[model samples]
Target: MFQDEARFGRMVRIRRCWAPKPARPMVGNGYEREFLYVYGAVSSLQGQFDWMITHIMNTTHMSEFLAQVSSAHRRDFIVMVVDGASSHKAHDLVVPENMRLLRLPPYSPELNPQEHVWDELREKEFPNRVFNDLESVRRQLEDGLPRLAANRASIRSLTAWPWIVSINLNAH
Candidate 1:
């Protein structure tokens, strides 16, 4: 599984919208710095994923999320590829027995396909909108994540890069 995190908040931007050829001025409700963090992981071969929404991104949350993923896939050996975040490398972080983490090279977000999941979430679920509050944003994410999870083909197309496919093929 490829792992990553995304942040969503009251800060909203007006994205492209359908308008006449002479487009009218577009307006957004404004922005706020308050945010929520979403931890996500995706399986390249099957497009399966697990995610958690948290108030903060820290070692505790990472460990908890890892535990959840491990529980969900307890029967299978999991090789989770994650970025070199400080929380991920925290000394107190507890990795599940059946799962191992592989840290991607520093500053290498492009190599982790889980990032695309964030893009999809933002584009489809949060575009051109201002959320009333943190809970409102959470509600939208709660609803949208399952829809994205069910879209196996889109996940596969977004994450199954050539090198990822090669790695999976060689692992077996």
Candidate 2:
């Protein structure tokens, strides 16, 4: 039940989590942390600041709103997947100083951990809903991120059926 984005006319529904903690914060005293889950896309350039697409393969736009995943131990990262995504195969992508690309099994979105990211972003974090504008959506997601990150199980459960109703809707 991962979240997916579809282009509808000119609007896009970007399912995302908002966890913008300062890159470097003062150590150990009392710091404020915030988290949010937002839906909808930026319709205009100004709106882009308010919303973003999570875990998208695209190279353009907010790097601040996204993060890349990799394993430090290659010995433990034995699972090789063949995700036939153009971005996975794109030659122009600028990964970290040294990163290797692996292909996931063709058409196997179910096996991807990222699938749960969108699913839970739209489900547990954000119940059935829509946003009127990008600001409102951003604020909502920004607030939801902390709770979402704390409960890793909640996000992982996104792959399960009951929580994945919307995710499986288009499968038929």
- Say which candidate scores most in TM-score: 1
Model 1, span 1-172: residue lDDT tens: 9999999898886688888878786666856788999999999889887899999999999999999999999988899898999999999999999888999999889889999888988999988888778999899989999999999998999888988888743245
Q: Could you tell me how far off, in angstroms, the CA of residue 49 lies in candidate 2 after the best superposition? A: 22
Candidate 1 segments whose C-alpha is farther than 4 A from its true place: 20-25, 169-172
Q: What is the TM-score of each candidate against the true structure?
A: 0.93, 0.45
TM-score of 1: 0.93
Q: List candidate 2 segments past 4 Å from native.
A: 1-57, 61-82, 153-172
lDDT comparing candidate 1 with the true structure: 0.90
lDDT of 1 at 27: 64
Estimate the lDDT of model 2: 0.37
Q: Kindly give the stretch of ten consecutive residues in candidate 2 with the minimal lDDT sum.
A: 41-50
lDDT tens readout by residue for model 2, 28-90? 221222223222211111111122434233543212222222222222222222256454355
